[model samples]
Target: MKNLNRKNAIVMGIGLLMLSVAQIAAHYNPNMPDSYKGFFMGTGLGIMILGLIKNKPKRAS
Candidate 1:
Protein backbone atom coordinates (compact mmCIF):
# COMPACT_ATOMS: atom_id res chain seq x y z
CA MET A 1 0.00 0.00 0.00
CA LYS A 2 1.21 3.48 -0.80
CA ASN A 3 1.75 5.92 2.02
CA LEU A 4 0.36 9.43 2.06
CA ASN A 5 2.65 12.37 1.26
CA ARG A 6 3.34 14.94 3.95
CA LYS A 7 0.97 17.54 2.48
CA ASN A 8 -1.89 15.10 2.09
CA ALA A 9 -1.41 13.85 5.62
CA ILE A 10 -1.62 17.40 6.94
CA VAL A 11 -4.77 18.06 4.96
CA MET A 12 -6.37 14.93 6.38
CA GLY A 13 -5.41 15.96 9.87
CA ILE A 14 -7.00 19.39 9.41
CA GLY A 15 -10.16 17.78 8.10
CA LEU A 16 -10.33 15.52 11.14
CA LEU A 17 -9.83 18.49 13.43
CA MET A 18 -12.67 20.33 11.73
CA LEU A 19 -14.94 17.33 12.13
CA SER A 20 -14.16 17.12 15.82
CA VAL A 21 -14.72 20.84 16.25
CA ALA A 22 -18.12 20.57 14.65
CA GLN A 23 -19.09 17.73 16.93
CA ILE A 24 -17.92 19.56 20.03
CA ALA A 25 -19.69 22.74 19.04
CA ALA A 26 -22.90 20.87 18.42
CA HIS A 27 -22.62 19.10 21.72
CA TYR A 28 -22.05 22.29 23.67
CA ASN A 29 -24.83 24.13 21.88
CA PRO A 30 -27.85 21.93 21.51
CA ASN A 31 -29.66 24.67 19.64
CA MET A 32 -27.09 24.73 16.82
CA PRO A 33 -28.77 24.55 13.44
CA ASP A 34 -28.50 21.43 11.34
CA SER A 35 -27.30 23.51 8.39
CA TYR A 36 -24.25 24.68 10.28
CA LYS A 37 -23.33 21.18 11.30
CA GLY A 38 -23.91 19.89 7.79
CA PHE A 39 -21.69 22.60 6.33
CA PHE A 40 -18.77 21.67 8.52
CA MET A 41 -19.30 17.95 7.98
CA GLY A 42 -19.48 18.38 4.24
CA THR A 43 -16.41 20.59 4.10
CA GLY A 44 -14.49 18.12 6.27
CA LEU A 45 -15.48 15.25 4.01
CA GLY A 46 -14.39 17.15 0.94
CA ILE A 47 -11.04 18.03 2.45
CA MET A 48 -10.49 14.45 3.53
CA ILE A 49 -11.33 13.23 0.04
CA LEU A 50 -8.76 15.59 -1.46
CA GLY A 51 -6.14 14.34 0.97
CA LEU A 52 -6.85 10.70 0.23
CA ILE A 53 -6.89 11.07 -3.53
CA LYS A 54 -3.81 10.40 -5.63
CA ASN A 55 -3.12 11.20 -9.24
CA LYS A 56 -3.83 8.49 -11.74
CA PRO A 57 -0.87 7.20 -13.72
CA LYS A 58 -0.95 7.90 -17.44
CA ARG A 59 -0.77 4.89 -19.71
CA ALA A 60 1.69 5.07 -22.59
CA SER A 61 0.16 4.59 -25.99
Candidate 2:
Protein backbone atom coordinates (compact mmCIF):
# COMPACT_ATOMS: atom_id res chain seq x y z
CA MET A 1 0.00 0.00 0.00
CA LYS A 2 2.85 2.36 0.76
CA ASN A 3 4.30 2.16 -2.70
CA LEU A 4 0.92 2.08 -4.42
CA ASN A 5 -0.54 5.34 -5.69
CA ARG A 6 -3.22 6.69 -7.99
CA LYS A 7 -1.07 6.81 -11.10
CA ASN A 8 0.59 3.49 -10.45
CA ALA A 9 -2.69 1.80 -9.79
CA ILE A 10 -4.16 3.22 -12.95
CA VAL A 11 -1.21 2.18 -15.06
CA MET A 12 -1.04 -1.29 -13.55
CA GLY A 13 -4.76 -1.70 -13.89
CA ILE A 14 -4.82 -0.66 -17.53
CA GLY A 15 -1.71 -2.65 -18.38
CA LEU A 16 -2.90 -5.84 -16.76
CA LEU A 17 -6.35 -5.28 -18.16
CA MET A 18 -5.05 -5.06 -21.69
CA LEU A 19 -3.01 -8.21 -21.19
CA SER A 20 -5.98 -10.05 -19.81
CA VAL A 21 -8.15 -8.84 -22.60
CA ALA A 22 -5.60 -9.95 -25.12
CA GLN A 23 -5.32 -13.35 -23.51
CA ILE A 24 -9.03 -13.86 -23.39
CA ALA A 25 -9.45 -12.70 -26.93
CA ALA A 26 -6.85 -15.11 -28.13
CA HIS A 27 -8.29 -17.97 -26.14
CA TYR A 28 -11.91 -17.37 -27.00
CA ASN A 29 -11.34 -16.21 -30.55
CA PRO A 30 -8.33 -17.80 -32.19
CA ASN A 31 -8.77 -16.11 -35.55
CA MET A 32 -7.57 -12.67 -34.48
CA PRO A 33 -4.96 -10.84 -36.54
CA ASP A 34 -1.38 -11.27 -35.41
CA SER A 35 -0.57 -7.60 -35.66
CA TYR A 36 -3.18 -6.60 -33.08
CA LYS A 37 -2.06 -9.35 -30.75
CA GLY A 38 1.52 -8.19 -30.90
CA PHE A 39 0.46 -4.62 -30.33
CA PHE A 40 -1.54 -5.54 -27.26
CA MET A 41 1.28 -7.55 -25.73
CA GLY A 42 3.85 -4.89 -26.48
CA THR A 43 1.82 -2.04 -25.05
CA GLY A 44 0.70 -4.07 -22.05
CA LEU A 45 4.22 -5.09 -21.12
CA GLY A 46 5.47 -1.58 -21.55
CA ILE A 47 2.76 -0.14 -19.33
CA MET A 48 3.32 -2.77 -16.65
CA ILE A 49 7.02 -2.00 -16.65
CA LEU A 50 6.17 1.64 -16.18
CA GLY A 51 3.86 0.67 -13.35
CA LEU A 52 6.63 -1.31 -11.69
CA ILE A 53 8.90 1.71 -11.83
CA LYS A 54 6.22 3.98 -10.43
CA ASN A 55 5.34 1.48 -7.70
CA LYS A 56 8.91 1.34 -6.42
CA PRO A 57 9.56 3.25 -3.21
CA LYS A 58 11.93 6.14 -3.57
CA ARG A 59 14.57 6.99 -0.98
CA ALA A 60 14.02 10.24 0.82
CA SER A 61 16.75 12.70 -0.05
Candidate 3:
Protein backbone atom coordinates (compact mmCIF):
# COMPACT_ATOMS: atom_id res chain seq x y z
CA MET A 1 0.00 0.00 0.00
CA LYS A 2 2.79 2.40 0.78
CA ASN A 3 4.29 1.98 -2.67
CA LEU A 4 1.09 2.90 -4.45
CA ASN A 5 0.70 6.47 -5.65
CA ARG A 6 -2.14 8.43 -7.19
CA LYS A 7 -1.32 7.66 -10.84
CA ASN A 8 -0.86 3.97 -10.21
CA ALA A 9 -4.07 3.83 -8.21
CA ILE A 10 -6.06 5.43 -11.03
CA VAL A 11 -4.62 3.08 -13.63
CA MET A 12 -5.34 0.06 -11.45
CA GLY A 13 -8.88 1.35 -10.85
CA ILE A 14 -9.51 1.61 -14.58
CA GLY A 15 -8.17 -1.91 -15.11
CA LEU A 16 -10.37 -3.23 -12.31
CA LEU A 17 -13.40 -1.56 -13.91
CA MET A 18 -12.65 -3.20 -17.24
CA LEU A 19 -12.32 -6.62 -15.61
CA SER A 20 -15.58 -6.07 -13.71
CA VAL A 21 -17.38 -5.27 -16.93
CA ALA A 22 -16.10 -8.45 -18.50
CA GLN A 23 -17.20 -10.51 -15.52
CA ILE A 24 -20.67 -8.93 -15.42
CA ALA A 25 -21.15 -9.32 -19.13
CA ALA A 26 -20.16 -12.96 -18.93
CA HIS A 27 -22.89 -13.71 -16.38
CA TYR A 28 -25.67 -11.36 -17.50
CA ASN A 29 -25.51 -11.07 -21.28
CA PRO A 30 -25.79 -14.22 -23.30
CA ASN A 31 -25.70 -12.13 -26.45
CA MET A 32 -22.27 -10.70 -25.64
CA PRO A 33 -19.53 -12.23 -27.73
CA ASP A 34 -16.44 -13.98 -26.38
CA SER A 35 -14.20 -11.66 -28.37
CA TYR A 36 -15.48 -8.65 -26.46
CA LYS A 37 -14.84 -10.36 -23.16
CA GLY A 38 -11.37 -11.35 -24.27
CA PHE A 39 -10.66 -7.79 -25.33
CA PHE A 40 -11.67 -6.40 -21.97
CA MET A 41 -9.74 -9.04 -20.08
CA GLY A 42 -6.61 -8.53 -22.15
CA THR A 43 -6.90 -4.77 -21.90
CA GLY A 44 -7.39 -4.92 -18.16
CA LEU A 45 -4.33 -7.10 -17.74
CA GLY A 46 -2.27 -4.85 -19.97
CA ILE A 47 -3.30 -1.77 -18.04
CA MET A 48 -2.43 -3.43 -14.73
CA ILE A 49 0.95 -4.45 -16.07
CA LEU A 50 1.60 -0.91 -17.15
CA GLY A 51 0.61 0.39 -13.76
CA LEU A 52 2.85 -2.07 -11.99
CA ILE A 53 5.74 -1.25 -14.26
CA LYS A 54 5.30 2.43 -13.61
CA ASN A 55 5.10 1.84 -9.89
CA LYS A 56 8.56 0.32 -9.77
CA PRO A 57 11.11 2.40 -7.92
CA LYS A 58 13.96 3.86 -9.95
CA ARG A 59 17.50 3.16 -8.83
CA ALA A 60 20.24 5.75 -8.92
CA SER A 61 22.59 5.19 -11.82
Candidate 4:
Protein backbone atom coordinates (compact mmCIF):
# COMPACT_ATOMS: atom_id res chain seq x y z
CA MET A 1 0.00 0.00 0.00
CA LYS A 2 2.79 2.40 0.90
CA ASN A 3 4.65 1.59 -2.27
CA LEU A 4 1.52 2.18 -4.32
CA ASN A 5 1.03 5.56 -2.70
CA ARG A 6 4.61 6.55 -3.39
CA LYS A 7 4.35 5.51 -7.04
CA ASN A 8 1.16 7.48 -7.42
CA ALA A 9 2.78 10.56 -5.92
CA ILE A 10 5.73 10.33 -8.28
CA VAL A 11 3.49 9.89 -11.29
CA MET A 12 1.40 12.90 -10.31
CA GLY A 13 4.50 14.98 -9.72
CA ILE A 14 5.86 14.13 -13.14
CA GLY A 15 2.52 15.02 -14.75
CA LEU A 16 2.53 18.38 -13.03
CA LEU A 17 6.10 19.03 -14.14
CA MET A 18 5.26 18.19 -17.74
CA LEU A 19 2.20 20.46 -17.63
CA SER A 20 4.33 23.31 -16.33
CA VAL A 21 6.88 22.84 -19.07
CA ALA A 22 4.15 22.81 -21.72
CA GLN A 23 2.68 26.02 -20.34
CA ILE A 24 6.06 27.74 -20.32
CA ALA A 25 6.82 26.64 -23.84
CA ALA A 26 3.48 27.90 -25.08
CA HIS A 27 4.00 31.23 -23.37
CA TYR A 28 7.49 31.79 -24.75
CA ASN A 29 6.76 30.68 -28.30
CA PRO A 30 3.64 32.38 -29.50
CA ASN A 31 4.29 31.26 -33.07
CA MET A 32 4.68 27.59 -32.26
CA PRO A 33 3.05 25.28 -34.76
CA ASP A 34 -0.36 23.75 -34.05
CA SER A 35 1.13 20.28 -34.37
CA TYR A 36 3.70 21.02 -31.67
CA LYS A 37 1.08 22.35 -29.28
CA GLY A 38 -1.15 19.37 -30.00
CA PHE A 39 1.69 17.00 -29.20
CA PHE A 40 2.43 18.69 -25.88
CA MET A 41 -1.25 18.71 -24.92
CA GLY A 42 -1.58 15.03 -25.75
CA THR A 43 1.54 14.12 -23.79
CA GLY A 44 0.46 16.12 -20.75
CA LEU A 45 -2.97 14.47 -20.80
CA GLY A 46 -1.42 11.01 -21.13
CA ILE A 47 0.81 11.61 -18.12
CA MET A 48 -2.14 12.81 -16.09
CA ILE A 49 -4.12 9.71 -17.04
CA LEU A 50 -1.23 7.53 -15.98
CA GLY A 51 -1.15 9.29 -12.63
CA LEU A 52 -4.86 8.71 -12.15
CA ILE A 53 -4.46 5.03 -12.96
CA LYS A 54 -1.62 4.77 -10.48
CA ASN A 55 -3.80 6.23 -7.77
CA LYS A 56 -6.71 3.88 -8.33
CA PRO A 57 -7.36 1.26 -5.65
CA LYS A 58 -6.94 -2.40 -6.49
CA ARG A 59 -9.79 -4.81 -5.89
CA ALA A 60 -9.37 -7.46 -3.23
CA SER A 61 -10.09 -11.06 -4.13
TM-score-wise, the better of 1 and 3 is 3
Model 1 residue 31 CA deviation (Å) reads 0.6
How far out, in Å, is residue 19 in model 2?
0.1
Worst 10 residues of 1 by lDDT: 50-59
TM-scores, in order shown? 0.83, 0.75, 0.85, 0.72
- CA error at residue 35 for candidate 1, angstroms: 0.2
- Return the candidate ranking by TM-score, descending: 3, 1, 2, 4
Q: What RMSD, rounded to one decimal, does every model reach?
A: 2.5, 2.0, 1.4, 3.0
Residue by residue across 1-61, what tens digits does model 4's lDDT show?
Answer: 3556877777777777777877788889999887787787778778878877768788899
Candidate 2: give the clashing pairs. none
> Relative to the true structure, how large is the alpha-carbon lDDT of every model?
0.83, 0.87, 0.90, 0.78
lDDT of 2 by residue, 1-61 (tens): 6658899989988999999889889888889998888899889989988988878777899
Candidate 3 residues lying further than 4 Å off, grouped into runs, are none
Arranged by lDDT with the best first, the candidates are 3, 2, 1, 4
Model 1: per-residue Cα lDDT over 1-61, one tens digit each = 1656777788888989889999999999999999999999889988988887742334799
Off by over 4 Å in 2: 56-61
Candidate 3, RMSD to the unseen true structure: 1.4
Cα-lDDT of candidate 4: 0.78
